[model samples]
Target: MNPTDKNAITESVSCPAVFIAAPASGQGKTTITAALARLLRNQGKVVRVFKTGPDYLDPQVLAQASGQPVDQLDLWMAGETYCRRRLFEAARSADVILVEGAMGIFDGEPSSADLAARFGLPMLIVMDVKGMAQTAAALVSGIANFRDDVSVVGLLANACASARHRELIELALPKDVPLLAALPRDSSLALPERHLGLVQASEVQEDLELRFEAGAKALASEALAEALMRLPPVVFEAPFEDPFVELPSMAGITVGVARDPAFSFVYQANLDLLQQMGAELCYFSPIADSCLPECDALWLPGGYPELYASSLAGNRSMKAALLGFFAADKPILAECGGLLYCLETLTDYNDQTHEMLGLLPGEGAMRGRRGCQGMQTADLPEGPVRAHAHHRSISQGTPEPITHGRRQRHPAPGEPIYRARRLTASYLHLFFPNNPTAVARLFSPEPQLQTCDQSDSRSLSDAVE
Candidate 1:
């Protein structure tokens, strides 16, 4: 059945909820949210972890913290109905639903506070009280008063040094507000970092679990657990409708998707939507997998392909298989990290360059290429394209003359601001369901300036790779 039909089968549900927010971005929302989910999961609760914005990395950490794939809840990106559906789905099996907010509570349009107010989830404000004492109360009070809709559950004194520090901050809070938890300024719990926020959980891979365990134990206590229990639930009706932007399904063939630790940043919803639209989905790992599955088209989603440069480079069979697909001229779609792997060479952090599929001209360069974030909408010479950017590697291609991207920054809320080509490669991971029509066209039989060879699957024993 198609996604629309399958979605109709989802039974709506809602349960106890808590929104981890802060006085501001540096107040440790991501850290606290991860720690809380980890602790709650340790308590045998099925924790449904979520983020309140279009963040890819934080959700990865949160998913690890709860031992489940995390989902996003953004009014701007996914809209209210879709967010409601995700919430409903989580409530079905999740014993507790924890949402990590972006930046300050009231920051960003369709802010976390807006989502919280819409869902009725109580907010626990975490403030980095390192810089002030009594003024902390004023800050929390300002957040509380800034919007009457957002409920102030309690304050957690982050970066506290000692009991005296916690006491002073606790006393400073309005007498009505309580100090839920106090985290001593322990440097040991600090997560790794680089140009972009915390090292994307995937970049850390095997070691992330150990770090998550330590952070959870360090942040959680009896008090935090009690405070979580007191958090008000976001009351809502049943059978919550899905909030899909609705893309029309085009007549198309099966499309294989590459998914593994090396290429797993694809939104789960995209896969679901693709299958719903009648295209078959075949998944294979380029790290060790030799043969591509039965597919008409192929999609390589973004991930830390640079980290596994050597392994992907050595995957001779995978390389050969991809080369076969190129021979077939199959419609191929790839994003950021995936885009990197498609190039002739990918440079690692140590400045070592390794050979990759040379179908695309550009090479991934480790040379410091900062200032690459924000949204972009492509007015592709082929058609309209909407995408985002978040990468560090600059292109070192011989003919890297703007194949198809208009650099966009500080794009207004809900604005289509960037465009690219049929073969778009950007750091900004996108959800196809947001634009079903374009998504449908991407995989449909409709021919534009380019077309894929219509062919049947080849045998795996002697597959392309």
Candidate 2:
């Protein structure tokens, strides 16, 4: 079924919505949001979950809690119209919409408070009140009063020491604001994290469901339940017309996408847009699969390849298939971790070197520092594309770059872009829906096949073997 079909008949929807925000990062915003989603789901409420930034990991946990795919709601990266459409779509079938905010309440150019104010959704502040008493209330008060348009509905104290600690915070809060819940300090309640952020939900094996249940139990206090019930209903009116641009068709093309532990950082909307543009998508795992599926184009998304470098390095058949795919000059788009896989070698954080596909002229090193991050725009051959870059690894080599990428804030030296034959690789993960036609052209087969030999039947086989 096409994802675009569901949005054809637009209608007004009234769903209670709230943003789970925090004073800063590591203040239990994601934890509380996941817990609330699970608690609401257990209560027979249909919950729609969203992450308020260009985050990939947190949404996985949120999706697990809500039993629905969690979409991103970003003001700049995804645009306002896309966010409104997603909110309306979720509200159509959900009783509540829970959005997990990123970093702090007012950190980035378009913060969580910005989104809340735009949608008129109330904000529930999650403050880590550990090692502080009445000061926590001051922080919440400042966030609430800083923005006249945004409303702070309630406050939740995280990592509190004792009943006295919770009482102190509650007493310090303004009379108009209420203390919704107080979560005691518990190490087990915290999710595992690495340099990037929380470990992906897919990597967490065994007792996953039990972990989410424990998280819900940690936050599902009597006060929280009551506070959730007291939230005002939200009425969302449909726009005068559809907000999405009509996508052109690519009916005769197939795009094979890599999906596994090493390469799973794809945006759902990007995939949906590709499908809407009339491309058939096939998913294959590089870690387990022996060969790639036959297709006109291939996309390798970014993920935690360093964590599973050994397994990926050992996949000889898959490596050969990728090399052959590049040799055949079929269009392939790789980003970040995917770019690492295309390199000659990858050195993990442990300083262990592993062989890679060697399709691109570069070697990647997992330096202990973030290589680059933030929103960027690349001047591609087709056009300018908006993308995000977040990785801790650096590629060392000089390949002929197809374009230069400039970050939105710091337009320093442009980012490196490597293009070998029909392959385009970089650390930037392009949000395909932003320019569907350009993305479609990047994956289109007609341009690549114009130079191919018609007698090479093996290039069109179902699998390498």
Candidate 3:
């Protein structure tokens, strides 16, 4: 059958979609999902994978495995319309859609089960059966039966010890819920991790390719990868109207985006939205670049800045360029690790203090294992934009915040939104598509912002020297 035309989409489209979920976190969901995607991709199929929540790392891995651009589908952060539209667009061309669930199946407020039910996608529960046998079947059975709205179609047993282990799980499962596949316990299939989560895919691309090939080869002999091709396609309807169609135009605006090992936690959707609104994105590296690109504004997304503190601090010319940008009152939006880079000082895990951009009067340091992560709305002076905070670092002695992020559930505020001159820095990473107008306002230059106190402006000038 011919694929649907991109420009001529009707009310709805259909494609086989699977929600790859787990009983809980660390069930090797990323490994299984990436491997499954790779398996199908190797068979000359178009696989579009999406991470279910505000995740950066998993999408990176999945995107590389599937050889397709991956997106994040969240009911709250991106909204139901965005999710539906994304699915519809994918269905137009993709052979199959795979959404890797976050944390657990029934984990968050709008849980993986909630999203699965909302879209009527079949669920494939992936469980690591290394230490257990029949109990795996019990857990899968319970999860399958727990919600009437969600349809549990099959199960993939990860890290099964032997044929005997696979037989034990298969025999215990219900007749309707068959064992799709049993991936062996192979150390070669394991992805590396850091303090945050899985290390960035770029850092381990060559090894990842080998792992993907190995994983695909592993799943090729199983029923799970083949079953994906035969699953019934779910109908995805397009939104009646594009809510952001009338977003403020960012014509003539060139935003310098920091894209490097230290600041790579950017959502593909955010970049897409910026271009859609007529803004040109110029990518530069804080860790490598000696000067800023000639642009109207700047955006620093989150990543492992703590890991590359020395490199960022050592780039004196780049630091001077940043100070000049700040002194000129150019707009800059920094999130999470970006927030850290703008601080006066940053202490690494080794307790080594490095001088930062000093765009804000603060010091950032790692908090060991403790971290803050949750969905919130950043109450920016431009407008409220939906965002989330996930970081293991903290800032001290920062200027007073202009506003605070409103928590998704609690009445109290979440992360502090600090505004230093034209810089809107925070630990919260804003989802641009959630409020394109607000995001446009953020990147657009404001003349009133030039009225920053004389002392602060002088300090920025002094730092430039």
Candidate 4:
């Protein structure tokens, strides 16, 4: 049989997996998921955790709790084959696989429910049950019975106060769906947050460690820890061939990636794709390093630029280095916070202004609680790459956009894509694996333009599906 064929006899790997989801956002999903991961890790079990959408902060926290590298799993952004292959590979070595969902269970286009149902992974709904008891059972029952395709194995009632609260929820639950555990309302279990989502793990690792231990002890009680261990192993099939095996090579091209507290939003998968395509990667810090790494191209991903605006402005040598690189016409990709850093001025949340790199004649200002966020396609001159926009800041007085982002659902144009010399700056974060060819060209010295397309994985998707 052809190894790449749909009828190919592929080997299967089995491992226990659970999709940790919630009724809606702000329901303590990350906290409970991290607790469960830490609880299992304390028992010496290798736990592999996957986040269900485009996120940077939660994955950092989850990775620390699980003691494993976390990967994002999205059906629309990453494709079915990519998600499947990641699961299969993790299953081979992982004792338990935990996928933390984004937003509500069935919120997005390819929602958490869609991924869970497709893979036959049962869901453990985490909801805040402080306000009601029997109502909790009602909501969970509706979610479980609403979709026949999805499987609901149990419910993890969060923020339960007294024994009476647990008893009311337990008694109202259907026999088929069990109440796994009732976690107490403890402030210590909560993860700190800011304008974005959770605080970066590196900033408060010690505090997170204390919270993780507290959460683990809570979940370890009432046989909840024992119940999670009993989840049946799910079978996963391996991909026939690696997707990047045939990607265009960028040999001898060294790309500099900004990686520090100020610009740490670079995707692991993006770096992986670059290396797989024969490109060399070097890391440099814009906040700490005075000079750019000796490389052919530069990538500055999004981060909390507003928080470090003063420090970034104080680093005069770094600004000069960046200007020199821009003057040389080297390719520089800046997204969100990176775009802010490139502007002439940036206003922080406190309204404090600081001078920036001035590579672009624009100013960025932080807007409290008001921002744009959605999936879009960067209609780049090189080619189209699937991307997303999530930022609280807005830009002013920049050059006219060379092109606009194609919104995922809306008919209107999304964020503006600005091109100054060889630099490509935008508020949208590009998912490189979606279109390796486009990304390769973006970072190359002379990009050869082509007809715009979503990705180079259509044939792979067809074969896998």
**Candidate 3 local accuracy as lDDT?**
0.87
lDDT of 2 by residue, 312-369 (tens): 9999999989888889989999998999999999999999999988988878999886
Which one is best on TM-score? Answer: 4
In model 4, pairs of residues that clash are none
Ranking by lDDT: 4, 3, 2, 1
Best by lDDT: 4
Model 3 stretches with alpha carbons more than 4 Å out:
1-10, 242-245, 447-465
Candidate 4 clashes: the total is 0
* TM-score for candidate 3, residues paired by index: 0.93
Clashes (backbone N, CA, C under 3 Å), per candidate, total 17, 0, 0, 0
Superior by lDDT: candidate 1 or candidate 2: 2
Over 137-206, each residue of candidate 1 has an lDDT whose tens digit, in order, gives 7888878778878888789888887888887888878866778888878766667766556777866856
Better of 3 and 4 by lDDT: 4
**Each model's C-alpha lDDT?**
0.69, 0.80, 0.87, 0.88
Candidate 3 C-alpha error for residue 18, in Å: 0.8
